[model samples]
Target: MSLAADLGIAFGRVAFVMLFVLNMGGLLTWVERKQSAIMQDRIGANRASILGLRLFGLFHPLADAIKMLTKEDFRPARADRVLFGLAPFVSVFFALTAFASIPFGDTLRVGGREIPLQAVTLNVGVLYVFAMLSLGVYGVMMAGWSSGNNFALLGGQRAAALMITAEVAIGASIMGVIMVYGSLNMMDIVRGQGALLWGWLPAWGIVTQPLAFVLFLTAGIAATKRIPFDMPEGESEIIGYFVEYSGMKFGMFAMADFLETVVIAGMTTSLFLGGWQVPYLDAAGVRLPWGWTWALPHLLVVLLQVGAFVLKVCAVIFFMMLIRWTLPRFRYDQAMRLGWLGLFPLSIANIVLTGLVLLLWGGRP
Candidate 1:
């Protein structure tokens, strides 16, 4: 409608997405502890509470926030003050912005005006998200180099190397999905997935590009720089890129990691797990393969799509956490080998195979 209304809608969408991303990032700190506890057969983070309200350590994140806020903001005496101060913000900013292009649901029609559920709609959303994620490396490098610490510099070098190895594989891995969807738009890709194959199976990326799914997920985990790929922050060795950071600055770096995890999960859900698409469910309602149709209200349909997307993202997050507990950290050399000699070539092969299959089939299968 009017320019003001359009701006208002855009602002609203941005607000909603930011709140969701930040809150999830915070909650994931709790999830990580609790999930790890259950897996290791121990109680975790249950001590933080207020007025006899434990809430199963739900208050830990809140307690963490307060502690970080009140802690002394420290900087190394030899550090470059400007870049050292700016790095954490850069990391958090890019991580949060990357989620802007992710579509949480389909269009929401209200008062005869259609509003997209995503914060931003881009013709090249995949590239946009990837670029944002790649930019985060600068923050890591900045944090390490500006800290004026030898250990931090070494950590930065490792981080850069790991990022390079993983990013190449990640870029190559998504090529097959692009070929299958035949569009760079994230919404287009998700919409393409809603179609049924053989009038029975949903045409999700996992079905069409199963190899890409596995490769992307593997590379995505490496990109997040978590356990088994966390040589950049080898705490066991008492070193890291942000080793000199303290207080909220350090918190920002930690938050950035969790935010990246959420972004990776969102990307996996969007690219391979059908995004907001529900089985047999369209904008109007559910139309089963066996001639059964259930018409749902527009609001309900939107809610269902959004809910499905949320659930899928959560499931992916849970799986990632499970992997975190299950696997031991890989040695740097082994991690690099897996990314370069293993995932990279496999991703390239997957692309070629996808191309051949599409050529023979004449379209998505």
Candidate 2:
């Protein structure tokens, strides 16, 4: 392919990822309200509508956008103008960029060329995503410290501490997966998961590294800083990091949180689930364990893979939202303790166990 074509493909992938994430993040706002309402046995977000058409509260996100856009943008009298203004953008930017490395489908072969379905392909994609996610804390710190509010500063400190605890546990937890897959590339790891164990069971990360999956999901939830791990924004007690933000600025912060949740779900899908890999399905066709072989077109196979990825991601998001409504918020001290004294050591132990199992099995999974 020519350089121009390559660049075009890259841009197309980027556009696809951006649109998918942004739409999902926006839709999640409605999902949260509706799902919570179902759990609590109440109507939620049905008030927003146009021309008497509610569309089952789907219009609420649009209503929210209008409200945020029309509301007055406020800044503290003693705030640092530049950093305070830039913080929300930083948070949203990193959250969006982190998804670039996640592969939603296998390569699409078209007209003598193969195109990857990911926005960006990198050998160290996992580390790249981790770095991007870790950098998001800077935005939180900036928002808090520049707000000129002691409460905000305390929230920022809590966020920083929680981030440290979560990141460490996350890093340690994924080491077992890295050992199992023997790859740092996200695509490579997902491809590795396509292998079948004992001619039947798919060799997914959750199958081989169940412990890592649990550890990673726990730490990933903490990384997103949602319910049960929302120490940075304990609205009932402390107003938390972006307390001084208002209008669209506050909306951006909120959007960043949802984007982070989507990223976590995507990462979990790529790492622990099978990403876009469908069981008994390969590039050519479906190969059943019981001696049945069904051939499928390449385009159809690609579509199936992509569809499976989307479904997996949505399922993970639903589970996350379920947890959000089912669990109460964690106290700061309790969250910190869970992160450090609980998850961290357990993650380390999981790594050691994985290494031993890999060694005993001749590094095969």
Error of 2 at 48 (Å): 1.8
Q: Whole-model Cα lDDT per candidate?
A: 0.93, 0.93
lDDT digits (tens) for residues 1-365 of candidate 1: 58889889999999999999999999999999999999989998999879998999999999999999999999989999999999999999999999999999999999889898999999999999999989999999999899999999999889988988888999999999999999888999999999999999999999989999999999999988898799999767748999999999999999999999999999999999999999999998999999899999999999999999999999999999998889999999999999999999999999899889888889774
CA lDDT, candidate 1, residue 348: 94
What 10-residue stretch in candidate 2 is worst by lDDT?
A: 356-365
Q: What is the lDDT of residue 244 in candidate 2?
A: 96
Which ranges of candidate 1 are over 4 A from the true structure? none
Top candidate, metric lDDT: 1
Cα lDDT tens digits, model 2, 281-329, are 9999999999899999999999999999999999999999999888999
